[model samples]
Target chain A: MKIILDAMGGDNAPDAVVRGALEAAKEFGVQIVLVGRGADILASMKAQGWDTLPDGVELANAEDVVDMHCDPAAVVKQHPNSSLVLGARMLAQGGGDAFISAGNTGALLTAATLLVKRIRGIRRAAFSPVLPTKDGHAILIDAGANAECTPEFLLQFGCMGSFYAQKALGIESPRVGLLNNGAEDTKGDPLHREAHQLLKRAAEQGTIHFVGNVEARDVPFGAADVIVADGFSGNVLLKTMEGTAMFMSDMMKQMFYRNPLTMLGALLCKKGINGIRKTMDYRETGGSIVIGISRPVIKAHGSSDDAAIRGAIRQAIRAVESGFCEEIRANIGQMILPREEEHAE
Target chain B: MKIILDAMGGDNAPDAVVRGALEAAKEFGVQIVLVGRGADILASMKAQGWDTLPDGVELANAEDVVDMHCDPAAVVKQHPNSSLVLGARMLAQGGGDAFISAGNTGALLTAATLLVKRIRGIRRAAFSPVLPTKDGHAILIDAGANAECTPEFLLQFGCMGSFYAQKALGIESPRVGLLNNGAEDTKGDPLHREAHQLLKRAAEQGTIHFVGNVEARDVPFGAADVIVADGFSGNVLLKTMEGTAMFMSDMMKQMFYRNPLTMLGALLCKKGINGIRKTMDYRETGGSIVIGISRPVIKAHGSSDDAAIRGAIRQAIRAVESGFCEEIRANIGQMILPREEEHAE
Candidate 1:
């Protein structure tokens, strides 16, 4: 399988991305296609004592770079030759099995959907990010990808999220949960209530394992394998978790450096603390996967380092290996679109 | 100001409630009326080495106790003499200037609204809680109080939340931000979009200081003094913050006690860490003051201990002394009611 990497996507681009790609290629033995400005990629390669591209590794040239502030749809349309857009185009045309970018999320998402297109039966594409928790990890879908959604769209998100969890996370029967105001079926607004009923019916038919509504507080504790929420709430939850993790980590550092004795204690437990930090790091899990598209496209964090870029490439590989797109297409195609049409009316 | 306390509420019950009330009464020089089984209050009183009931401290007999499982509205009607209901009633009827309860939140909110009633022009009441953040604190308004709301109702939340911050937290021209998926005016669903427009209008009129939309990640860093969101989203944010705080606190404790050296280090910084813990403790800040009510009524945490219950009582006194209810009535009354009516049509 071939994976295209945006070498200029993240903060520590080229070096970090190239190094990470080399590591992934060495370990996974998958073809690594670095897509970026030609000279920059080659210079970085030469700096690492590589005169030429190694076996199982190739370079794809793209002249221009898409900055983080670029308009997603406009950039993809105007600069089809840009690395970010071309990466997605390559995947669509089967030049590579998957594409990864740690550039502008908006551009990445737009390129994936507009270029690669959504799978048949998929109402909308959802982004699922694996959140690390005490009990392990849980997937939160539509994490701010599409802000507004109908009940049918949310149902589709659940199906897509569940399949991703089953195929990628290796969960036998992923417990799917609807993120709602309360656990009761009658808890949320009309959209949530309708989705609850649909999910209940689906669960009864064994289409997906529904665990009912899980509140935001339970998200960090790994309440379910696939936690589906509208983008508005899911975005808030995701950012809140990220912000809290950073805040707590900062506070811990302060506590450790307050005095000599505490600093000593910090040093002693460095390994354990590092373990916890690693668990919370986004790079370790790769970036969020833009699910429901016809091809695998992963979004790396804009500020991601080479490590994160490489992680995103690895995730792309995993997505391809797991047949994520195919699974989503299969599961989502079963939904009745007639009700959705009526609801729109 | 005379404050009524529900001694029968919370995990610690009469013991913590009685002790906290006595302490608050003595410290603040405000009358505290403990409402519960007289025997339990008196028994705990003697154990605390009190020779006589302090000045401005008294008790009101209420035989019934509202359990966490009881239906909120039903309980208020069924148990008119229940501690929680009677306590709020005292504040409503001018028997007490304010009321405090660390009981069932649903019960507290129901009784407060039904008995105390909204101020003449106040449409819906709001529950505001101070969330701890790295940048200090941010007020999350309508935190699960009014789930479904019009944009105008949310505008009132911003105003009321701003009032609370200016009076309580002492921020001048406090920044009010609408919590949404993204920071753009066009970022969120219809509710958020309309709310953003209303906030812009309010800012233009110089009625309330309005900041642009803020994301959840910025919430922990005190992005704005008053963070306005619909109750559903607000509640989720509140609980997420609470859960994250608890999780971090627990993890810190576990880290400290993991080894003998770390345990010794914990001992050395015991005073400093305790100080931090005390500040982070929601008990110290008391509870949400059901804003827009005719009188001051604080909804203490359901699991509050003696210290927390007393803190709630004191918060009631502060709310009354600061004329928080009157301020909200005067500042937010006109806008809030008319907005609700307009949205109803």
Candidate 2:
């Protein structure tokens, strides 16, 4: 399998991206096409003591680079030869099986939708990221793709997220849940209430394993395997969990470093603290997968380091190997047809 | 000051409520009127081995009790003599200066809105809770009151939350922020984008200290003193924080009790851990204040203990003494007038 990497993206850029690509190529035994400015990419590789591209790895030079601050909607149009645009085009043109980028999220989404395009009958694409929970991890769909969503959009998210969870996470029948303020069907705004009816119907048809409404408080308890929400609420839920974890971790550090006695305790408790930290770390979960696109597209964090990039690459390989996109394409029609047919009837 | 308490509310009601009322009456030198089933309240008081009611404390008869499962909108009419309804009526009749209940949130909001009513010119009342942050605390308005909101409602929430933060939390000029998916003005759904423009205008007119959009990730780091969101998002944010904190705290406990070595480490780090726990505790911050009401009303947590009830009483007294309702009423006109006039013009 071949994977295209946007080496010019992210804060660490050429250095971390290049190192991660080399590592991923060795580890995954898959061909990696690194796309970026020729000079910068070569300098980064040389700085790492590489005379030439390593085995299973190659470089595709792109003249332009899309800055993080540029307009996402306009990047593809303006920077036609930018690394992100070129990488996406490579995946669309069958040069690579998957595309990975740690760039501006909006730009990536824009490129994916405009170039790779959405699956047939898919109204919108969603960003699904695996978030840490108590037992394991849960997929939060539409993490920040579309701010405003209709009930139909959310129902599609539930189906897509369920498929992603089953194929990617190896869950036999991932329990799909609608994220809401309360567990009752009557809870939440009109969108959620309407979506609940559709999700229930989908569950009844056995297309998706629909769990009832899951509250934000129950999310970390692994209440559901695939937690589906509109982009706005899903984004808020994912970020709030991240922020709270960060705040608690920072507070823990401050407490340990406060005085000599606490320092001694920290030393003894280091293993356990590290254990919890590792569980909470985003890098361990890899990058967010942009679901609903025709091909697999993974979005690494903009501040991704070498390990995060490697993680993203691993996620890309998994998506490609699992044939998750094809699975979604095959199952989504059945999942959505009943509702539409019922409406027509 | 006189405060009305719904003794028949909450999971630990009657017992915790009576004890807390007695404690508040003695500590704050305020009159406390416990409203509940006459016989049940007396039995709970006697069970605590209190032969007589304390000075400045009394009881009022409320024969009915509103269970948590009932519909919030229909609670007042269905159970007219319920403790929650009676307490609200007492506040409305000027029988008490304030009302506090650790009951069903929807039922409380229904009773308060039906009885005490909204402050004139306010589109809707909001539930403002002082959530813990790194520095101190920030007020999240419409925490779970109105699940659906218009731009006008959120703008009013900003005004009311700002006033509450200033008068109650003592922030001279509370920075009000619209909670959105991104910090950029252009980010978020149409509701947020429209609210952002209005909030910006309010800041320009000096009605509020609008600091523009605040993302969920920044909420825990003291990003803004007054965070304004529609009830659905605000409820998700508030509950997610609480849930994350609970998860972390539970993990910390598990880590400490894992083995003998870790247990000793826990002992040595107990002070610091307890300090962090105290900082995250909701009891320390008291209950959520039902803002935009004519009179001060507080909704304590349903599972509140004596300490939480006491905290709620303290918040109620603070609200009553601060003349917060009058403050909101006085400035609400200016906060809302410009938007209406602008549309008209």
lDDT of 1 by residue, A20-107 (tens): 8887898888998899999999999899877888899998899989986687769887778888988888888889988888788878
Top candidate on TM-score is: 2
DockQ of 2: 0.80
Clash list (residue pairs), candidate 1: A16-A306, B16-B306
What TM-score number comes out for model 1?
0.94
i-RMS of candidate 2? 0.9
The 0-to-1 C-alpha lDDT of every candidate, in the order given, reads: 0.82, 0.90
Candidate 2 chain B least-lDDT 10 residues: B336-345
How many pairs of residues in model 2 come into backbone collision? 0
| TM-score for each predicted model, relative to the true structure | 0.94, 0.98
lDDT of 2: 0.90
- Tens digit per residue, CA lDDT, model 2, B168-271: 77899999999999988899988899889888988998899999999999999999999999999898899899889888888888888878888888888888
What is the DockQ (computed on Cα atoms) for candidate 1? Answer: 0.54
Q: What is the lDDT of residue A325 in candidate 2?
A: 87
